[model samples]
Target: MNNPTRTIISRRSRPAKEPLSKDIIVKTALELLKSEGSSGLSMRKIAKALDTGPSSLYVYVTNHQELSAFVLDAGMESVVLSNEEGVSWEIRLYETLHSYLTVLMEFPGVAGLALNTIPIGPHSLALTEYILERLHEAGIHSTSAAWGLDLLMLYASSVAFEQASRAENGTTLQAISASYRSLNDKQYPMIASLQSELITSDGEERFRWGLEAILQGILQRQSKFGI
Candidate 1:
């Protein structure tokens, strides 16, 4: 009799016969982004990873820009919006934004890609819808709420890009602090006086502080205009 266990093992170890689809290309591209940064990711590298040629990758993705967009959207697939009810919009917004940040930051170069790409993918649209819905529920006027989405996304993406770029450049907060401390006090007395406050905050602390400030400004505008 044939050994069923050996057959199962062989099947499990078999390589895929058809793996050149768009999904497979995007998945492999994301892995390339992780191993090598944005500058390092190329069609040639992805093709090599898949045991194919660079020309073959163009059949799935037109070019590097399109591939980058796909990678960014794939990274966003991990952000699961919470369903816990009875929470205030402020809390919901905070949690959602944090979750979104968490997802982007997990992929080193993907965050930087968000700066240029228009978010039209399925997951990106879902995130935009959820953010706008929360802002509307929080008493923001239609005009303000719509604009707030733009500002919120720009802020989050820019922050993530900055963090990622600094990491790639081997820069640290301590080095920034030292640079600030070395500034000519006479030329920048105000910055010199507040040096400690400017450079003392860690990444998470600084991010939370700025996020709270932006949210407070939005709430204040609503109250001021009675929207």
Candidate 2:
């Protein structure tokens, strides 16, 4: 029995950091986003910018995708989602979409974050829920209500991406319009005809048109459902 003695050892495993905290990692990543835009925000670069080992960042963010999500969530916090005084869904919808556009525009790198994905995180879900609730109040059916929100997100994000792309390419709205005008009329006649109107609008006007079109679709559904 005395010969059956044993020794025990203990070990510790550290868990990773969550990037949700408003701290140096997030701050540095945002600075990188501002300086380099979406493509430029890499883990290694962010680590370098923050003067930390890349592995530390890995503990918090798995990759650029996660980083993008984090950025969009944090950036979207700037959006104010609420009703205008006694406003109808049409007007409320307009105000909401406008606020969303302003939020993404605030951090120009943000639109790139939400380009095509169905956002499901807490922040994104909150906004989506708000939009759907408004649509439901507008008498839109559940199916159309869901799709309308999708369309609105796509249109606003796409426009924001386009504006960011043009700015990156050193093109102005006027220059873009002029370039459109230069296209051959023999082909793309519709585009050529509408080219001026197309490029002449700042992103805000374009966003309003898109938002209104989506709202009209919602209204069509609303009328059908209301009856």
Candidate 3:
């Protein structure tokens, strides 16, 4: 029954913490975002996760807004840009956008950041460049291509955000259907008549239809306006 001996551990034997850098900070922020959504992306939470003071993060990131942009772009690194030699520009563009939507849905917080933050990171630039190239191949150039790029990204981000919100709030299509069913047909004839069609397709089908519709609109506008 001798007294338990305490063993002293040398600090030098402990594993050294990884050096802080912009890349590490962005990566950590992305992890937090994935785990806890947008709320987890605060400077204090990130610093705590890294076992450092919140002020230490300032050396790498200018502010939370800038870090958000970095985190959004880092999340976009997974977007697959198809470069198949034989694929049509339309198909490639659709696939690229689908890939982008998939990435946003996977990282729901990133969708919110994409809507709010102006991404300037290399990955974001690459995605934009890829979309622009496809649009250029389709004879969409100058202002039309630029505007189309913005429209495409906005549509995808918005859809992702909407889905994320629904997921977080435990909303369902059935709930919407039930609410629509309760509407007064006399007061809302169109909505009452089209309720079935409105909720018919699954998300993937609706998303594809939206992408095609937007592409068609852009093409029509470019043709009519010659821009």
Best by TM-score: 3
lDDT of 1 by residue, 1-227 (tens): 88767735567687776658999989888888877878557888888888999998889888777877788888899887765798887777777877887777765688877888877678888999998888878787766777778888888888887877777778998899899988999999999999888767657778777777887787788788755
Q: Give the candidates in order of TM-score, highest first.
A: 3, 1, 2
Number of clashes in model 3?
0
- lDDT digits (tens) for residues 143-165 of candidate 2: 78778888888888877777666
Candidate 2 vs candidate 3: the TM-score winner is 3
Model 3, CA-based lDDT:
0.91
Best by lDDT: 3
As for lDDT, the candidate ahead, 1 or 3, is 3
User: Model 3 — which ten-residue stretch has the worst lDDT?
Assistant: 1-10
Each model's TM-score?
A: 0.83, 0.77, 0.94
Q: Per lDDT, what order, best first?
A: 3, 1, 2
Assess the local accuracy of residue 192 in candidate 2 as a C-alpha lDDT between 0 and 100.
81
Q: What TM-score does model 3 achieve against the real structure?
A: 0.94
Candidate 3 at residue 109, lDDT? 88
